[model samples]
Target: MSEHGVDSNQIRELGRQALGDAHLQEAYRSSTLRLYTHRLAAVSEVPGFERLRERARELKREVMDHLDFYLAQFAENVERRGGIVHWAESAEEARSIVGEIARRAGASEVVKAKTMVSEEIELNPALEKAGIRPFETDLGEFILQLSGERPAHIVAPAIHMTRHDVSDLFVHNLHSQPTEVPEQLTAIARRALREKFASAGMGLSGANFAVAETGTVVVIENEGNIRFCTTAPRVHVALIGIEKLIPRLADLAVFLRLLGRSGTGQKLTVYTSLLTGPRRPGEDGPEEMHVVLIDNGRIATLADEKMREALYCIRCGACLNTCPVYRKIGGHAYGWVYSGPIGALVTPQLTGIQNARELPFASSLCGACRDVCPVKINIPDLLLHLRSEAQERAPAPTPSGAALGERTTIRLWAWAMKRPWAYSLGSRLARWGQRLLARGGWIRKIPMYPASGWTDGRDLPALARKTFRERWTEIEKQ
Candidate 1:
């Protein structure tokens, strides 16, 4: 596997290990289920919740349509606010831009707030390679950093960690006595991180939204760490994807309203900071502030009429909790910086169709995510789009005959679906087979090439004894 590519099989095994680890699974399950329930309650609080989603959808659509104008406007505003704006066309460019800024600023140790774009570009590894220590200030990130693991969830990075696992880690890494309680474990982490926070020379963050009119970058967080990172450091740098820019300051009202409700079911995030520029002459803040606007495949995405909607995602991770496939396989199985329904669409486009060919087919197409999205990204529609994108290029040559047979079966199904009569005939044949296969009022087994394979693990619900068309035939005879 390539260094950049995710090993899904390995991830699957890891997820299983993590799941069976008992201590971590309960912590993860409890935390995730709580957040999921809260989000539902928060959205329910609003009388016109669905209406707000519709408006937010329109706003995102409008901003994305005139993205060029907003990006230019945002850059200009950054300059006016005593901040330099750097445009990074690729991951390497983003790294080099930040690296250059760090070198010139004489920053040896940098503290990072939660930023997924940085992960996409492998920023921590790059910074380490440059002899600069990049510390993860977010508690979730800090844990994953210690464990040398990738984030398991979008909003909650270390969602996979159990309280007991945390206790073990604190016992090992921070030299604290082992305790399974959440409070003690958190206290240990807090004490250890405070020293790093105080000594950090620079702070790096990712923007949730950039107001083009004000050139203000907004960051929303539950933890106090991001606040400390931005305020304590001599230099502050923000990394944001180009799609993050929204047109007006007023437009923030709609996004902020929906963001928290969708993310954790909180009426509002604990902290919502909107910083337009660096410290003024009288202000006590970072002396130097820079914002890196990263394009990395965003331009290619912008050109895509159908898939551009994927760019509107706010990274709430609601889709992950709701997605049946993601719930089973977890983030690692998607094989990229992203996972879940949104990842199913965005990953293939961000990398290449060839790179994420298997991901589009991973979804159950239940449309649960589409119903929950604050910005109303039509997730199921996008999944279908990705599936088409996947099929455009044939899977590479497989030495294994199993893979070849599977490919042939898929090809045959695709061809048959194109012909209405062939599809109807296949459906009729399937119905006929179900008549015998079904026993005790349900299909317990079906002995056919694919049906047998499917029924091996799952009980097949038998077809209705008579089709609607057949029932209609009896009515006509009567």
Candidate 2:
């Protein structure tokens, strides 16, 4: 297997592992179902849901098309409001910029909100390398942090872990008594994170939208921990993607309506704070505010006219909840910061397609993602585009021995398909030859053929006596 390509064997192994774990299966299935049910109810109550989605799409398109102008304008306004803006073309640059900020602040500890971009750049490890301990404020993120695990879902990061699992983790890690109660678990996390919020020298977060009109960055969260991270710390750093821009503050209202409803079934998130810059005069907020605009492969993404719709994603994870494939194997199988439908579409692009070739093929192309996306991104179309790109960029090598023989047999079958007489003769030969392998009307195995691997798990259907074309011709004559 190519180093860039995801190993097919690894995918199968992870899938089989997930399927065998009854607890993990239940955790993913129930959580995703709940979110799906909530989203349906919330979206149904809105009168113009589709129109709202289109409006959101339009706003994003406008911002994306004029990205440079808005980005500059947004930076100028932020500077005017006593904040600093940094531009990072790559993940290394972003990390260095953030590390400098933390080091300058003499920070020993940093508090962070739930930010996918931070995950994308692997920020926590960098901060640790800089001798600054970073604490995850979001409940799900905190759980993953404690357990040393990656996020299994986009919105609900620890959706794969059950309450019992969490309880055991806490008991083992935090030295707390085992308790499966959700509220107690939340309290345990809140208590542990509260000290980090107060003692940390800086806070780091990701913005949902960066409005060019007022140079305001908007963050929406239900936990209220984000509120503390943005305000409690002396220095606050917001890492934003170049694509997360809007022309005006007024446009934010349209997205606010869709984000919460589509994500967790609320009219709006519990805490929606707009921070223009650092604290002013007597107002209580961070003393220093910095916005780092990251363009880690987003410029290339924007260049692709066919896949640009992916830039409109708002990180809602609604598509994940609605996807059947995501519900089964779960997010860990995708082997990246993101998972599910959005992951399948964007990961190969964000990471090199060569490194993530299997990501595109991970999808079933069911179109549920397109149905639930608030911005109405054509996820299926993008998946197909990436699948084709994967095949073109990284074709599978021909195997030697029995596998090579199977390849030769398939090629011969294709040749026979082009000629009518050969195809008829081939069908008759297959019927007679398959009888040798068939047992109880099924092919148990085929020695020296790659078909055995497939038949190892499930029986192959027995071949028919006559081809469909032959039967159809006879019926026509009658």
> Can you write out model 1's per-residue Cα lDDT over 207-229, one digit (the tens) per residue?
99999999999999988788878
Report residue 315 deviation for candidate 2 (angstroms): 0.9
TM-score against native, each model:
0.89, 0.93
* Clash list (residue pairs), candidate 2: none
The candidate maximizing lDDT is 2
User: Candidate 1 overall Cα lDDT vs. reference?
Assistant: 0.82
The list of candidate 1 runs beyond 4 A from truth reads 8-28, 394-449, 461-475
Question: Candidate 1 deviates by what RMSD?
Answer: 3.3
TM value for model 1: 0.89
The CA lDDT of each predicted structure is 0.82, 0.89
Q: Clashing residue pairs in candidate 1, if any?
A: 24-162, 39-265
**Residue 198, model 1: Cα distance from true site in angstroms:** 2.5
Candidate 2 per-residue lDDT over residues 302-402, each given as its tens digit: 99988888999998999999999889988887777788889887787888887777777777788988999999999999989987887678654453335
